[model samples]
Target: MSTRTDEVERYEHLWQEPAYPHRWVLWDTAGDVLVFDRETNCLVDFDDESVLPDVLGRMRAAGVPESGDYPGRPCA
Candidate 1:
Protein backbone atom coordinates (compact mmCIF):
# COMPACT_ATOMS: atom_id res chain seq x y z
CA MET A 1 0.00 0.00 0.00
CA SER A 2 0.99 3.60 -0.52
CA THR A 3 2.53 5.64 2.31
CA ARG A 4 -0.49 7.94 2.53
CA THR A 5 -2.82 4.97 2.86
CA ASP A 6 -0.62 3.48 5.53
CA GLU A 7 -0.65 6.74 7.42
CA VAL A 8 -4.43 6.93 7.23
CA GLU A 9 -4.73 3.39 8.52
CA ARG A 10 -2.40 4.19 11.38
CA TYR A 11 -4.41 7.21 12.31
CA GLU A 12 -7.64 5.23 12.37
CA HIS A 13 -6.08 2.50 14.46
CA LEU A 14 -4.82 5.07 16.92
CA TRP A 15 -8.32 6.29 17.63
CA GLN A 16 -10.11 3.03 17.06
CA GLU A 17 -10.56 2.53 20.77
CA PRO A 18 -11.47 5.17 23.27
CA ALA A 19 -9.14 5.92 26.19
CA TYR A 20 -11.35 5.47 29.20
CA PRO A 21 -10.70 7.21 32.52
CA HIS A 22 -8.47 9.54 30.58
CA ARG A 23 -9.53 12.56 28.58
CA TRP A 24 -7.93 13.86 25.38
CA VAL A 25 -7.13 17.30 24.16
CA LEU A 26 -5.82 19.02 21.07
CA TRP A 27 -2.36 20.25 21.97
CA ASP A 28 -1.29 23.26 19.99
CA THR A 29 2.47 23.69 19.76
CA ALA A 30 2.41 26.91 17.76
CA GLY A 31 4.27 25.21 14.94
CA ASP A 32 1.74 22.38 14.72
CA VAL A 33 -1.10 20.65 16.57
CA LEU A 34 -1.68 17.14 17.82
CA VAL A 35 -4.25 14.92 19.48
CA PHE A 36 -2.89 14.12 22.91
CA ASP A 37 -4.28 10.79 24.00
CA ARG A 38 -3.86 11.06 27.74
CA GLU A 39 -4.30 7.42 28.66
CA THR A 40 -1.69 6.10 26.28
CA ASN A 41 0.28 9.30 26.16
CA CYS A 42 0.09 9.03 22.39
CA LEU A 43 0.72 12.15 20.39
CA VAL A 44 -0.73 12.13 16.91
CA ASP A 45 0.43 14.86 14.60
CA PHE A 46 -2.24 17.33 13.56
CA ASP A 47 -0.91 19.87 11.07
CA ASP A 48 -3.99 21.90 10.31
CA GLU A 49 -6.39 23.95 12.36
CA SER A 50 -9.09 23.70 9.70
CA VAL A 51 -9.61 20.03 10.43
CA LEU A 52 -10.55 20.68 14.08
CA PRO A 53 -14.23 21.16 13.31
CA ASP A 54 -14.42 18.00 11.26
CA VAL A 55 -12.47 15.99 13.83
CA LEU A 56 -14.62 17.26 16.69
CA GLY A 57 -17.72 16.60 14.60
CA ARG A 58 -16.69 13.00 14.12
CA MET A 59 -15.96 12.67 17.83
CA ARG A 60 -19.39 14.02 18.75
CA ALA A 61 -21.01 11.72 16.19
CA ALA A 62 -19.18 8.83 17.84
CA GLY A 63 -20.71 9.96 21.18
CA VAL A 64 -17.63 11.62 22.60
CA PRO A 65 -18.35 14.81 24.48
CA GLU A 66 -17.68 18.10 22.68
CA SER A 67 -14.66 20.22 23.58
CA GLY A 68 -14.32 23.89 24.30
CA ASP A 69 -12.10 26.57 22.76
CA TYR A 70 -8.51 25.85 21.89
CA PRO A 71 -6.24 25.91 24.89
CA GLY A 72 -3.43 27.36 22.75
CA ARG A 73 -0.85 25.82 25.03
CA PRO A 74 2.52 24.47 23.98
CA CYS A 75 2.90 20.71 23.79
CA ALA A 76 4.62 19.48 26.91
Candidate 2:
Protein backbone atom coordinates (compact mmCIF):
# COMPACT_ATOMS: atom_id res chain seq x y z
CA MET A 1 0.00 0.00 0.00
CA SER A 2 1.31 3.40 -1.00
CA THR A 3 0.86 6.36 1.30
CA ARG A 4 0.16 8.64 -1.66
CA THR A 5 -3.16 7.02 -2.56
CA ASP A 6 -6.73 7.45 -1.34
CA GLU A 7 -10.09 5.96 -2.30
CA VAL A 8 -13.68 6.64 -1.32
CA GLU A 9 -17.10 5.35 -2.39
CA ARG A 10 -20.38 6.64 -1.07
CA TYR A 11 -22.86 4.07 0.10
CA GLU A 12 -25.71 4.55 -2.40
CA HIS A 13 -28.41 3.21 -0.11
CA LEU A 14 -27.30 5.35 2.80
CA TRP A 15 -26.95 8.33 0.50
CA GLN A 16 -30.75 8.51 0.16
CA GLU A 17 -31.57 7.74 3.76
CA PRO A 18 -32.70 10.44 6.19
CA ALA A 19 -29.52 10.26 8.20
CA TYR A 20 -26.37 11.29 6.45
CA PRO A 21 -24.44 8.13 7.09
CA HIS A 22 -21.57 6.99 4.91
CA ARG A 23 -19.98 3.57 4.65
CA TRP A 24 -16.44 4.01 3.44
CA VAL A 25 -13.90 1.47 2.23
CA LEU A 26 -10.58 3.19 1.90
CA TRP A 27 -7.48 1.91 0.13
CA ASP A 28 -3.88 3.07 0.24
CA THR A 29 -2.63 1.32 -2.86
CA ALA A 30 -1.10 3.28 -5.71
CA GLY A 31 -2.93 1.30 -8.39
CA ASP A 32 -6.06 -0.13 -6.83
CA VAL A 33 -9.59 1.24 -6.83
CA LEU A 34 -12.64 -0.38 -5.32
CA VAL A 35 -16.20 -0.41 -6.62
CA PHE A 36 -18.64 -1.91 -4.18
CA ASP A 37 -22.37 -2.29 -4.47
CA ARG A 38 -24.34 -1.08 -1.47
CA GLU A 39 -27.04 -3.70 -1.86
CA THR A 40 -24.70 -6.67 -2.07
CA ASN A 41 -21.74 -5.39 -0.02
CA CYS A 42 -19.25 -7.18 -2.23
CA LEU A 43 -15.70 -6.03 -2.87
CA VAL A 44 -14.57 -5.55 -6.46
CA ASP A 45 -10.93 -4.68 -6.83
CA PHE A 46 -9.88 -2.68 -9.88
CA ASP A 47 -6.12 -2.42 -9.92
CA ASP A 48 -6.00 0.51 -12.29
CA GLU A 49 -5.38 4.23 -11.91
CA SER A 50 -6.96 5.15 -15.25
CA VAL A 51 -10.42 5.80 -13.82
CA LEU A 52 -9.08 8.37 -11.36
CA PRO A 53 -8.54 10.93 -14.11
CA ASP A 54 -12.24 11.08 -14.89
CA VAL A 55 -13.12 11.18 -11.22
CA LEU A 56 -10.67 13.99 -10.58
CA GLY A 57 -11.93 15.86 -13.62
CA ARG A 58 -15.46 15.75 -12.25
CA MET A 59 -14.31 17.01 -8.88
CA ARG A 60 -12.30 19.79 -10.49
CA ALA A 61 -15.30 20.81 -12.57
CA ALA A 62 -17.31 21.03 -9.37
CA GLY A 63 -14.78 23.53 -7.98
CA VAL A 64 -13.36 21.08 -5.49
CA PRO A 65 -9.82 19.85 -5.35
CA GLU A 66 -9.21 16.21 -6.25
CA SER A 67 -8.08 15.88 -2.65
CA GLY A 68 -9.32 17.62 0.50
CA ASP A 69 -6.35 17.73 2.80
CA TYR A 70 -3.81 20.54 2.64
CA PRO A 71 -1.00 19.14 4.66
CA GLY A 72 1.31 21.77 3.27
CA ARG A 73 -0.81 24.64 4.52
CA PRO A 74 1.21 26.83 6.81
CA CYS A 75 -0.03 27.32 10.34
CA ALA A 76 -1.42 30.78 10.83
Candidate 3:
Protein backbone atom coordinates (compact mmCIF):
# COMPACT_ATOMS: atom_id res chain seq x y z
CA MET A 1 0.00 0.00 0.00
CA SER A 2 2.71 2.52 -0.99
CA THR A 3 2.38 5.46 -3.27
CA ARG A 4 5.21 6.79 -5.51
CA THR A 5 5.64 9.87 -3.33
CA ASP A 6 5.84 7.68 -0.27
CA GLU A 7 8.48 5.53 -1.94
CA VAL A 8 10.60 8.57 -2.84
CA GLU A 9 10.41 10.03 0.64
CA ARG A 10 11.28 6.71 2.19
CA TYR A 11 14.45 6.36 0.12
CA GLU A 12 15.50 10.00 0.03
CA HIS A 13 18.18 9.74 2.66
CA LEU A 14 20.01 6.83 1.07
CA TRP A 15 20.53 8.82 -2.10
CA GLN A 16 24.20 9.65 -2.19
CA GLU A 17 26.72 11.11 -4.54
CA PRO A 18 28.00 8.70 -7.14
CA ALA A 19 31.71 7.95 -7.39
CA TYR A 20 33.65 10.46 -9.45
CA PRO A 21 32.88 8.77 -12.73
CA HIS A 22 30.20 6.20 -12.16
CA ARG A 23 26.46 6.27 -11.64
CA TRP A 24 24.76 3.92 -9.17
CA VAL A 25 21.69 1.92 -8.18
CA LEU A 26 20.32 1.38 -4.72
CA TRP A 27 17.27 0.04 -2.97
CA ASP A 28 14.68 1.88 -0.96
CA THR A 29 13.57 0.68 2.46
CA ALA A 30 10.82 -1.21 0.67
CA GLY A 31 13.30 -2.73 -1.76
CA ASP A 32 12.58 -0.85 -4.96
CA VAL A 33 15.05 0.22 -7.62
CA LEU A 34 16.41 3.77 -7.57
CA VAL A 35 18.88 5.19 -10.04
CA PHE A 36 21.20 8.05 -9.17
CA ASP A 37 21.62 10.96 -11.52
CA ARG A 38 24.99 12.62 -10.98
CA GLU A 39 24.19 15.86 -12.70
CA THR A 40 21.01 16.39 -10.77
CA ASN A 41 22.30 14.76 -7.65
CA CYS A 42 19.05 12.87 -7.16
CA LEU A 43 17.39 9.52 -7.71
CA VAL A 44 14.92 8.82 -10.47
CA ASP A 45 12.20 6.29 -9.80
CA PHE A 46 10.84 4.20 -12.59
CA ASP A 47 7.41 2.65 -12.54
CA ASP A 48 7.95 0.43 -15.53
CA GLU A 49 10.62 -2.20 -15.09
CA SER A 50 10.81 -2.47 -18.86
CA VAL A 51 12.43 0.98 -18.97
CA LEU A 52 15.39 -0.20 -16.94
CA PRO A 53 17.43 -1.28 -19.92
CA ASP A 54 16.86 2.02 -21.66
CA VAL A 55 17.76 3.99 -18.56
CA LEU A 56 20.91 1.95 -18.10
CA GLY A 57 21.78 2.50 -21.72
CA ARG A 58 21.51 6.26 -21.32
CA MET A 59 23.64 6.11 -18.20
CA ARG A 60 26.25 3.99 -19.97
CA ALA A 61 26.30 6.39 -22.87
CA ALA A 62 27.07 9.10 -20.36
CA GLY A 63 29.93 6.92 -19.01
CA VAL A 64 28.25 5.13 -16.14
CA PRO A 65 29.04 1.44 -15.81
CA GLU A 66 26.59 -1.23 -14.83
CA SER A 67 26.10 -1.02 -11.08
CA GLY A 68 24.54 -3.94 -9.26
CA ASP A 69 25.25 -3.17 -5.63
CA TYR A 70 25.59 -0.47 -3.05
CA PRO A 71 28.58 -0.77 -0.75
CA GLY A 72 27.81 -3.97 1.21
CA ARG A 73 24.17 -4.02 0.14
CA PRO A 74 22.94 -5.52 -3.12
CA CYS A 75 20.96 -3.27 -5.47
CA ALA A 76 17.27 -4.05 -5.63
Candidate 4:
Protein backbone atom coordinates (compact mmCIF):
# COMPACT_ATOMS: atom_id res chain seq x y z
CA MET A 1 0.00 0.00 0.00
CA SER A 2 1.22 3.46 -0.84
CA THR A 3 1.54 5.98 1.97
CA ARG A 4 -0.24 9.34 1.65
CA THR A 5 3.09 11.11 1.36
CA ASP A 6 4.15 8.65 -1.29
CA GLU A 7 0.95 9.20 -3.23
CA VAL A 8 1.36 12.95 -3.03
CA GLU A 9 4.88 12.75 -4.32
CA ARG A 10 3.83 10.43 -7.08
CA TYR A 11 1.43 13.05 -8.40
CA GLU A 12 3.39 16.19 -7.61
CA HIS A 13 4.80 16.43 -11.08
CA LEU A 14 1.31 16.83 -12.45
CA TRP A 15 0.51 19.86 -10.35
CA GLN A 16 -0.39 23.04 -12.13
CA GLU A 17 -1.93 26.32 -11.14
CA PRO A 18 -5.50 25.67 -10.12
CA ALA A 19 -8.50 27.39 -11.67
CA TYR A 20 -9.42 28.49 -8.17
CA PRO A 21 -7.04 30.45 -6.01
CA HIS A 22 -6.08 27.88 -3.40
CA ARG A 23 -7.59 24.51 -4.11
CA TRP A 24 -7.86 21.99 -6.92
CA VAL A 25 -9.57 18.61 -7.20
CA LEU A 26 -8.48 15.84 -9.52
CA TRP A 27 -8.25 12.12 -9.99
CA ASP A 28 -5.28 9.86 -10.40
CA THR A 29 -4.54 7.30 -13.09
CA ALA A 30 -6.29 4.61 -11.11
CA GLY A 31 -9.40 6.81 -10.73
CA ASP A 32 -8.64 7.79 -7.14
CA VAL A 33 -9.60 11.26 -6.04
CA LEU A 34 -7.02 13.75 -4.77
CA VAL A 35 -7.20 17.32 -3.60
CA PHE A 36 -4.35 19.80 -3.53
CA ASP A 37 -4.22 22.90 -1.41
CA ARG A 38 -1.98 25.76 -2.44
CA GLU A 39 -2.13 27.65 0.82
CA THR A 40 -0.86 24.72 2.85
CA ASN A 41 1.10 23.13 0.00
CA CYS A 42 -0.53 19.89 0.96
CA LEU A 43 -2.07 17.06 -1.01
CA VAL A 44 -4.96 14.92 0.23
CA ASP A 45 -5.58 11.47 -1.19
CA PHE A 46 -9.16 10.36 -0.60
CA ASP A 47 -8.55 6.64 -0.54
CA ASP A 48 -11.10 5.83 2.10
CA GLU A 49 -14.45 4.94 0.58
CA SER A 50 -16.44 6.29 3.51
CA VAL A 51 -14.83 9.72 3.55
CA LEU A 52 -15.16 10.62 -0.13
CA PRO A 53 -18.37 12.60 0.22
CA ASP A 54 -16.97 14.58 3.12
CA VAL A 55 -13.74 15.15 1.29
CA LEU A 56 -15.64 16.44 -1.76
CA GLY A 57 -17.79 18.58 0.46
CA ARG A 58 -14.72 20.22 1.91
CA MET A 59 -13.27 20.72 -1.54
CA ARG A 60 -16.47 22.29 -2.76
CA ALA A 61 -16.45 24.56 0.26
CA ALA A 62 -12.91 25.51 -0.66
CA GLY A 63 -14.10 26.67 -4.10
CA VAL A 64 -13.58 23.59 -6.17
CA PRO A 65 -16.45 22.92 -8.55
CA GLU A 66 -18.97 20.26 -7.60
CA SER A 67 -19.18 18.93 -11.12
CA GLY A 68 -17.94 15.51 -12.16
CA ASP A 69 -16.70 17.00 -15.44
CA TYR A 70 -13.43 18.52 -14.37
CA PRO A 71 -10.82 19.69 -16.86
CA GLY A 72 -8.89 16.48 -16.94
CA ARG A 73 -10.98 13.39 -16.33
CA PRO A 74 -8.17 11.08 -15.34
CA CYS A 75 -5.49 13.44 -14.15
CA ALA A 76 -2.49 11.19 -13.95
Best by lDDT: 1
lDDT (CA) per prediction = 0.50, 0.34, 0.48, 0.47
| RMSD (Å) per prediction | 5.9, 12.6, 9.9, 9.2
lDDT, model 3, position 45: 61
For candidate 4, write residues 1-76 as lDDT tens digits: 8665564344443343465443555434346565644444455544454555555554455456433333332434
Where does the lowest 10-residue lDDT sum fall in candidate 4? 66-75
TM-scores, all candidates, are 0.39, 0.27, 0.34, 0.35
User: Sorted on TM-score, highest at the top, how do the candidates line up?
Assistant: 1, 4, 3, 2
Per-residue lDDT tens digits of candidate 1, residues 7-73? 3444453344665542565555665445666555666455554555556444445554324445334
> Model 2 clash pairs?
none
lDDT of 3 by residue, 1-76 (tens): 9764564444333233354644454423345445665445566666655655555444455554444444233334
Which regions in candidate 3 have their CA more than 4 angstroms from the true location?
1-44, 65-76
Residue 28, model 1, lDDT: 57
Model 4 off-target regions past 4 Å? 1-23, 26-45, 68-70, 73-76
TM-score of candidate 2 to 2 decimals: 0.27
- True-structure lDDT of candidate 3: 0.48
Q: Count the backbone clashes (under 3 Å) in each candidate.
A: 0, 0, 0, 0
